[model samples]
Target: DQQVKQNSPSLSVQEGRISILNCDYTNSMFDYFLWYKKYPAEGPTFLISISSIKDKNEDGRFTVFLNKSAKHLSLHIVPSQPGDSAVYFCAASALYISSGSARQLTFGSGTQLTVLP
Candidate 1:
């Protein structure tokens, strides 16, 4: 099954606090994991990513940790701002074929993150 699972449908937090979102996968073939942030009616923006070779990746206030042994991953946002309030999606990809061979990612339903100002 291509199920990338985000157990929580939503999260709410006050500003300047930490926001953590979790994800799990059934497919062990996934070699690349990515996190994307989306606003309504817009495409998700690539935030950060971790190769299966690495256990963690970070960018600015965002961090992602992957536990290959556990088939699990999480995203952490420190001091979350109201601007951070949006849908966060966890996606997994395995190598695919094409001229460019763009990786095909399996996406979770997404977790809506709301940060209070």
Candidate 2:
């Protein structure tokens, strides 16, 4: 069973517009959340991250919001650009006391975002 899920497999937006990507999780143990962007044939690059302690985190054009009660999170990108077109992945990590680390990361299948000019 997939703990993390991205309901939308693809999204399209016009350039200079806002793009909203959503994700949901069934795991309550998840404490750390991350959003990654990937281009074709390349590795996924870290975009932004938010800890469970904070409900929201913002970095430039990217913002991540976590709603613990709803077990949901969303990524917002303002003024989306053509270069921002890529596969976006939502990942979560839960700390393991035995390992004292967040080694296991659960990833969603990913949502392909296309920014049309």
The candidate maximizing lDDT is 2
Error of 1 at 104 (Å): 0.9
How well is each residue in 1-117 modelled by candidate 2, as lDDT tens digits? 789999999999999999999999999989999999999999989999999999999999999999999999999999899999999999999988876884588999999999999
Worst 10 residues of 2 by lDDT: 96-105
Instruction: Give one clash count per candidate, in the order shown.
Output: 0, 0
C-alpha TM-scores of all predictions: 0.93, 0.97
Q: For model 1, what is the error of residue 105's alpha carbon versus the real structure, in angstroms, after optimal superposition?
A: 1.0
Q: List the residue pairs that clash in candidate 1.
A: none
> Which regions in candidate 2 have their CA more than 4 angstroms from the true location?
none
Score candidate 1 by TM-score against the native.
0.93
